[model samples]
Target: MISVYIGMGSNLDGPVAQLEQAILTLTNHTELHNIAVSPIYSSKPVGPQDQPDYANAVMRLDTKLSAIALLDLLQSVEQEQRRVRDRHWGPRTLDLDILLYGDELIDTPRLSVPHPYMLERGFVIQPLNDLSPELMLANGRRVQEHLSQLDTSDLVIIKEV
Candidate 1:
């Protein structure tokens, strides 16, 4: 099994409930095991501040599925949660992203490992640090190191997992 970190977020249709149900869906997946979830954090929306703040967390999973397959599974969960991708970084019911896949560096049309902007986003870094402070990204920076550099003034821990 390979270790994978997934970032979860929602800002619509009850963000907390959306995240909780998504976690259940991931934990119940047949190919995913040894699930670990971080505390949920509330943060300002990344774009279009008109929307509600987002509830976000990071999840760790040991899985037998390939990276693309895992991405597919995540997308399915989002769809089940009624995710609508009508606008970039717009509010949604769910957003599941593969933040890291072990130590692998992947950049394909369908996915990008290390999540492209995990280091720069406090929403991703804060909860990620809660789960694995020592985790080294594919780019070699430690999770806590990234957390320390980010301005988390807009983040608030809403719930502990």
Candidate 2:
């Protein structure tokens, strides 16, 4: 099984409930195992501050599915949760993204592994650090080291769960 990480968030009703349900959904999948979850963090919306802040967390899973397949699974989960993608970075009921897949770097029309924005987004990096502090990036640096190099002042951990 390949070790993979997923970032999950929701700003709508019962955000924590949505996250918990999503985690259960992924674990129920026959292809995923060894599931692990990070403590949930409440964060301010990244793009449009007008919307409600979000509850976010990272999940680690050992999966037998390929990258594209895993992406498909996440999309299905979003759809099942009624996530609307009417606008870019808009508010949603659920959002999931591929953060990392083993040490493989991929760039394809359909998908990209080691999510392109992983390093740039504090929301993603912070929760990831909580889940795996010493986790190494494909480039050979630890996640906490990368997080230290970032400015997460705008991203507040309003609560922990």
Best by TM-score: 1
lDDT of 1 at 128: 86
Off by over 4 Å in 2: 153-161
Clashing pairs in 1: none
Q: In candidate 1, how many Å is residue 78 off?
A: 0.5
lDDT of 1 by residue, 100-134 (tens): 89888899999988689888899998888988999
Best by lDDT, which number? 1
Clashes (N, CA, C under 3 Å) per candidate: 0, 0
